[model samples]
Target: MPATPAPAEFPEDLTLGIRELDDQHKTLFAVLDRILAVSRDPYRQLDDDGTNTVLDIMTDLKDAAMQHFDQEETLMDQRDYPGLDDQQEAHERFLDDLVRIEADLMNGTAVPPVRLHADLADQLAAHVREMDRELAQFLNKSEK
Candidate 1:
């Protein structure tokens, strides 16, 4: 019989050149993968404790992700970063996706495990490219 593969991992290229931001992004990626795994494990029906664990992970993802955004926003404010608004909008969209996932899990829905993971990974990659990298460049430029 074939074996199931391991869960998803945070891609190296997603690093934003900001320690806290990068760490949180990595954590979010892992948490998302974990959530998806738990939700899809046919052998494990999420019991109350399992449900609470998933909920806790979701809360952590939301809190840590928002905290990273706050850190980036604070830095942007300090540098008067031009791309701050766009970053905030993207952050809001990411948070909305998390809320939807959390709601689905709470309601015992299918949760679209694979697609949700893929969507979050894609969003993170795109956000890093579109927003975080720009901010990183601005910060580096201003430092020189």
Candidate 2:
């Protein structure tokens, strides 16, 4: 029997209290968790099938992130959020990093699945805590 993959942790503090953004965030983390499960064994390298699975998950993550960012940026734009530019830059950087990782994995370069998952999860959580938190506050205030 195969062992179950561990789910990625999304801290409570990372919650931005926006339904759409929060839902998207959960989707993003779930994708990352899938990666974690695929690479659950740190001592062993991923097999070809595992590599393919990770690649697919990466694509899904990127797609989800792009859609989420679009919605988020649109919201920010609608409200004239001052941090929109910075948020966009950060989103672009993250997508670029994902592309690079995908290329590396496709070219037979080894990227530890667990570490990759952790890094992605941490980066996203930090972004939510710092940037998205502010955006949430601004958005909530604007809605009032």
List candidate 1 stretches off by more than 4 Å: 1-4, 39-52
Error of 2 at 30 (Å): 0.6
Local accuracy of candidate 2 as per-residue lDDT tens digits, 25-47: 99999888888677548435688
Candidates in order, TM-scores: namely: 0.79, 0.91
lDDT of 1 by residue, 62-143 (tens): 8978888888788888899988888888889889988887887787763344555567678877887667878877887899
lDDT of each: 0.73, 0.87
Number of clashes in every candidate structure?
0, 0
- 108 Cα displacement, candidate 2 (Å): 2.3
Q: How close is each model in CA RMSD to the real structure?
A: 3.0, 2.1
- TM-score of model number 1: 0.79
In Å, residue 112's CA in model 2 sits off its true spot by: 1.2
Candidate 2 all-Cα RMSD = 2.1
